[model samples]
Target: MNKKQILTGFLAVTIFAACQQGTANQDKAKDGKSISAGAKVPAAPDAAILTFEKESYDFGKIKQGEKVHYDFKFRNTGKTPLIISNATATCGCTIPEIPKAPVKPGDEGIIKVVFNSTGKMGIQDKVITVTSNANPEINEVHLKGEVTEP
Candidate 1:
């Protein structure tokens, strides 16, 4: 190839490599949290942890059309405050209530789950998914029971 052509290709390759290097450097800060373009990134957490007393509950046998409720207790076992962002249930028959306020470090909280057996029968298993600022980010609690015809 001609000298000009070779020199041009070399310059192009150099520019491309430099651009890639800059992009990779900006992808994350020194602490490893990703940095977004023109948007504020969330700060690294200080080890907010959530610990549950029990991950599952059994209501045993209940009559159809009856409702059952249980409280899933938890504690913030880390150095930072624990904030529950949301709580979701597997089905409409199960409803979960998560505290709106943050649970401070070493503090305790409760998540209440109510299962409606109005039209349900036989063995029923429901799940509640809790989202928080904890390390794992999500947690699951289960509710199981047998509903007999009234």
Candidate 2:
């Protein structure tokens, strides 16, 4: 073939190769394969529901240097299991514990919070954020109490 024809043929082959590569990449994505670049993969079946009996708790009042406990009950209102991934307190003095097992639909669970008033005084407001598979994915629970001087 002439030089022009040769160049045109090479161009066609290059374009074809690029198109094939793109199709392959799309196929990989469809097959749940990660590309070379590190990107966040979406979780499978991305919807859930969680219902809480009470979002906030009032401890009323407690003496300084004392520890108090509270339980925040919730229900799995969604079709799938409710998995609480983690729970975090607003301050070090406040600790929270959550169930690791999945709560089935229509089942009940509890998030227990403990507030330590050691060295802490006056009115206090704390928060615990619970992360889960529930739709909206995060739940906030509040605690408030007045700490009397020991």
Question: Highest TM-score, which number?
Answer: 1
- Candidate 1: the clashing residue pairs are none
Off by over 4 Å in 1: 1-45
Query: Candidate 1 lDDT, tens digit per residue, 12-124?
Result: 99999989877776666577877855654454577678899999899999999999999999999888888999999989999999999999999999999999999998999
Each candidate: RMSD to true structure?
A: 6.7, 8.4
What does the lDDT read for residue 12 in candidate 2?
100
Question: What TM-score does structure 2 among the candidates reach?
Answer: 0.70
Judge candidate 1 at residue 127 and give its lDDT: 86
Query: In candidate 2, which residue pairs clash?
Result: none
Best by lDDT: 1
In the range 1-150, model 2's lDDT, one tens digit per residue, is: 899999999999999999887666643355777564344345556355778899988888889999989999999878888899999998999999999899998899999999999998898989899999888688898999899987
